[model samples]
Target: MLKLFRSAASIAALILGIAGVFLVLYAWRLPPFTGTVQTTDNAYVRGQVTIISPQLAGYLAEVAVQDFQHVKAGQVLVKIDDRIFEQKLQQAKATLASQQAALANSEQKRRSDEARIASSKAQVDSAKAALTAAEANWKRIEPLLERGVTTQSQADQARASLDQATAALHQADAAEEVARQDLTSTLVNRQSLEAAVQSAEAAVHLAEIDLQNTRIVAPQDGRLGEVGARVGQYVAAGTQLMALVPEKVWVIANFKETQLAGMKVGQPVTFTVDALQHAELTGHIERFSPAAGSEFSVLRADNATGNFTKVAQRVPVRIAIDPNQPLAERLAPGMSVIVSADTSTAASDVPATGTAPGATPPAQVSEQ
Candidate 1:
């Protein structure tokens, strides 16, 4: 009975020893999981796509580009029927020429008016000199008639001649005033003609701008898409004809409000595209949405209905890609990607090999 008790004691001791060892091993292997982050697979590669539209309405004469083709900035992509535009331009030029001629004619008329005014002034001076000489003769004859050395009829004749010369001088002065008034009126007319010329010149400038718009060109280096117009198709002003997607790409991550505690601008991020396997990319948190994504939507949730249930909201985080990667002109808009961001690290600690795999250590995470 003592041997049986000893055996049972040994079994109990063995079990206790095993339990202690297991505890020690577990304590050594366990990691400090301060926090567990959640992630989502919903992410995409995006960029600015320029929508090509016409500035003037016309039938398309030719399409100089094809779908999915690469194009450079200022490269002509289409041509509109310029016949009407060219005609309009010619008409404007003709109108401008006519206006210029009218302006020149107005200047010439002003000169003629000045000449008439000068001639009238000269006549007034000549008449004044004649009247002075006749008055001098009459003054001498009146004294002689009173002394009886000159006849009364001769003296009266001299007086009448002086009076006629005075009247002629007055008429010459009035004619001179009339000529000055005419010159002033002509200048006013010239100004009105000058204004008309200015209006015609403005129309000419507009016609020139319209003529330039007949040829369309790409605004930046991008991939062409959605080319809807064809040769001989009449397109109106502001009509969308094609789209150009820029080569540069970025990721738009919709992160929940709770996860944004440490997520700040300039934090590093690692990403993988579903379209391009074996390819990884790196980026930084450029900015966070100012408000929840729903707040910016067309129909925001109304929690004011009184039956309120608390729910986490998401905000869009923009992540700019590192330019050193072998992006190779392959990144396009709306491409699906899996993004993982590291909000714990500083911008300076992040290596330039940001795009390198195995650089950012993955965090202990949960699925969102």
Candidate 2:
């Protein structure tokens, strides 16, 4: 009876050992217990975080937002001392007005010069008529003096009148030429004045732009981080005032290269957020990185120079988180998550090349 009892106990122990081994295999999904879902712990939540900064230098007049405050697009976030900017705008306007006045004055001068030219032309016409009459009188007097019908004194008087008329005509011609030159100069001066007006107008526009820059506004609807600016604090151009976190976010999963053989865009995905008590969320495969993770590193390993040991390379896969989930709003950038892709349901027609058709290449790939 003792031997029989020992045999039964040994048999039960062996059966239990076999069951434990199966359980371990099933948990690890190895051999007969393999699954179609590919999973990786190297994943994180990411969003576009915008750094807020000023484009100009000024003392802070007002900080309109608190830390982590929700803001709307174009909402004023900070107000710089705008007194100087206002003054500058006014100065530019004054300059523009002065230029315009100069242009108008030039127009009036142009009209006056035209009138003077017309009057000089009329005078030239009168001078020409007088010279013609003087020439006729001189010719008649010379003939009479030769025939002794007129005295030498009469001839001398006629010659003197002709000489005076010639001198007068020359003076009138000179005056007319001076008047025409004056008109040309006036027209040229008007062009310069018009150019000056345009230049002043441009200056006014630049001043207005600077004034607008004094009021730093939100570029989009988002939540602002801590405000680094305070009342009366002087800040220069490009000084970071705060950070803006947008509402749109997604997940990045770094999977082993071997796992990418079955993965494709639009494949169903599920991820568990570590921050939210491992709550599972649904998503889909959005895109694949163009290169492996090592290619983006600041210092890359050179296999030719060093002892080569083969290591599995990680490829970043972008996952789009589904909207309207209650926990999705709570998700923030930089949160750790575990991602799994269900490749079993992937369409057979879809190529597993990891890139979508007709998609533009991204400028940069995020490793995290």
Q: Please give the clash total of every predicted structure, in order.
A: 0, 0
Per lDDT, the best of the predicted structures is 2
| Local accuracy by lDDT, each model | 0.80, 0.90
What TM-score does prediction 1 earn?
A: 0.82
Positional deviation of 264 in candidate 2, in angstroms?
Answer: 1.9
Cα-based TM-score, every candidate: 0.82, 0.84
* Candidate 2 lDDT by residue in tens digits, 1-368: 99999999999999999999999999876789878899999999999999999998989999999999999999999999999999999999999999999999999999999999999989999989999999999999998999999899999999999998899899999999999999999998888999999999999999999999999999999888888989999999999999999988999999988787767777889999999999999998888887899999999998898588999899899998988899999999999999999877746644343464345444553343
Model 2 score (lDDT)? 0.90
* lDDT of model 1, residue 297: 92
- Candidate 2's displacement at residue 168, Å, is 2.9
List runs of model 1 lying over 4 Å from the truth: 1-38, 347-368
Q: Lowest summed-lDDT stretch of 10 residues in model 1?
A: 353-362
